[model samples]
Target: MRHAETVTFGGSALNRAAELRGDKADVLALNENSRSIALWRGKPLICGTNLDQLALLPVSQDLFSEADEPPVPPIFLGQSEDGSALFAHDISAWEPAALDTAAMQQFVDPTQQHHPALPDDHRFVELRGVMAQLSARDAELAATARSIFGWHRSHRFCSNCGAESRMAMSGWQRNCPTCKTSHFPRTDPVVIMLITRGNKVLMGRSPGWPDGMYSLLAGFVEPGETLEAAVRREVYEEAGIRVGAVSYLSSQPWPFPSSLMFGCAGEALNEDITVDPHEIEDALWISREDMLTVFSGQHPTMKPSRKGAIAHFLLRNWLADRLD
Candidate 1:
């Protein structure tokens, strides 16, 4: 696919400066630079009514003034074209959430709400809701910020010695004071399969998704499993359909707490679907013609995957016969 790299959060080469991460003086100097981007909560500071897109704020922006609480140390995202440093600072501690049942949804679009605490010129919005509209560069930066900060939030204590760990390597690692063990950020691997038989593709939906919402069958790759094996296993486990030939398609960096989604195309050898209640709520085979309707939002019962996600990307390319 011509737009493979253009997928959200995967295209830009951030040129992550690993060596500078351990250098305290250099990392501190980079944080003081004017070009850094600050991420508050899960949202990156954006300029204007462009809720569909992200506009990074300068490190010197007044938005940092409201960040009174101590944030997890900034991560060195990498360098831009002119050798200017790009960093992601977490101000999540300053942003409080009023959780409700509505917050149960995995993805939220905050473009509709005006954050009263933020400056009038900028609003921090959820990236998943606006990823399709963001430029490849913006998406990549936002993903990096969310993933790194999320890791820090969950791994505050050492697993080895049960001691509190401190951030090190410019937010790339955590070091235990007691055991001196180091822990790095983790990216969970998942296989999202586009399983096909003749002219139809298999899709399924979890219990609580929006009405008519369906997506490619996906599951986490287990220990001692290859991507292909995971795809075949996930299909059979979820839909009870046997898969034969599985091949790689494209990949997307999904930063909902950091996971790498591997898209794959699989040829199904059997059509009968015995939906596993434990894995899937419903499973069905939709013909190509019906899929076109879903993509166009004209289908009566089925809706396409969320835009900018690997499922949507793979399905779109498959519809156009461009998955190579």
Candidate 2:
């Protein structure tokens, strides 16, 4: 699609300085100077405070948590405008209670502690707006953080030798102590596409989505399969539609447990959709005019895709005549 990169998370151009991950002192120095920051709920948590703030937390992991601790070595996320190095924190190593939603919300909202406002100079307020408006750069960083940390959590034992692996390369890799095997993080690729024969676009609903919520057909790219092949297979498998001449449109790093979404536009060779009961609950093709109504919140039964996701991005651009 022409406006593919104009998609929400696709637009923000955050510079991720990947070359500095191996230099411990340099990475630490950058974190020591960064200003704009936010925290993530899973991996890649934005530590709004400095090193001292981490020390001040009442429940440090070494004292209270049973999980294996992450190496103190930090990963370089990138840099702020003033040249301060952005760093990611694996709060995964911290005690659960210290990073729980309730506790973090209190930090974000200091009024919960009954503290008086200090002329609005609070750091939380300073960073709140930017954090709330999710950026493409932040989305990429968060996905990287979640995927790497999740790899660390699940791959602690070496698959080859059954030995415990230690974190290396500032959390980018795991080295098995006994077998000398190295493990790297993984991103599973998924294909999400809008199949259009003419004015109508196909959409489907999975078993657990919110009532009335439907989205473009999507499925994971299997081993050794091309992206176009995956799109065709997935559409056939889920809705019994024969897809042809699939074309790449855009992509998004969806961090709902680590997925890279490949957005595409495909041609449906057949119009009849035979819904696969096991994979989808219902399937239908909504016309362009009705899709506009759906986008405008006037559809009687269907709701548009969630805002931050690629499906919404694809559909919106398609409607705007920017995806052709």
Candidate 3:
């Protein structure tokens, strides 16, 4: 697809400084520089008023050392325009009373309130709620910060010897000091397909989705499987439909704990669905005209997928003949 890179979290050309990952002195210098961004949890600091771009704070800001708390180590995100170093520092250990309730939620707390000691115009907003409003650059930065930090949070223990691991390579890897094993951040592949036959397309909804919410069928790519195989398998397993002639469309970096979604277009060989109750609650085919109604908010039975997700992007482009 010619406009594939225009998808959310797709277009930024971040200059990941791989050479400096192992340089202790240079990494420290960049951390102390005044052009770094301090991210609390996964939310990047943004202007509470504008909320369209990143509000990068200086490294020496009082917020970092508030209550006599030492600033956390910085992870180099790469150089941005003007050749200034762009970094992300995890201030999650701050443990402010305002954020006490956020610890219980599996996702980032969407509370937009300002930190008690921070400036009134600055606050942290969850990326999913405001991603469509952010510029491509800000989206990229937020996605990268979330993915790296999530990996660090889940990979603190070694898989090889069941021993605890230490951070290495400036947040890109973990090393087991006892077993001499090294672990790198992982990105699982998922296949999300637009299966079509004649004028209708296939979609399914998992349990717990909002009322009338439906999206393209998707599942993780299993071990040693090709993208084509995964697409076929997922469709068959979920909706009991066989797919053929799979073709790649576009992709997005889904950073809810780090996964890449490969969007694909598949030709459905059969329309009869026998849904697996274990995988999804329901599956059905919707005509193009009805889909248009759903998108326009005139349909009563279903609603289109949320904006900024690949499913919405694909369906919109398909409707407008922009998928080429």
TM-score of 3: 0.92
Estimate, for each residue in 88-118, the C-alpha lDDT of model 3 and write its tens digit: 7777766656554654363435576467777
TM-scores of the models, in the order given = 0.91, 0.77, 0.92
Local accuracy by lDDT, each model: 0.80, 0.65, 0.83
Top candidate, metric TM-score: 3
Q: What's model 2's overall lDDT?
A: 0.65
In model 1, which regions exceed 4 Å deviation? Answer: 1-3, 24-33, 62-66, 95-119
Q: Report the lDDT of model 2 for residue 76.
A: 50
lDDT ranking of the models? 3, 1, 2
TM-score of 2: 0.77
Candidate 1 C-alpha lDDT tens digits along 208-249? 888888999999999999999999999999999999999888
* Model with the higher TM-score, candidate 1 or 2: 1
Lowest lDDT 10-residue stretch of candidate 2: 111-120
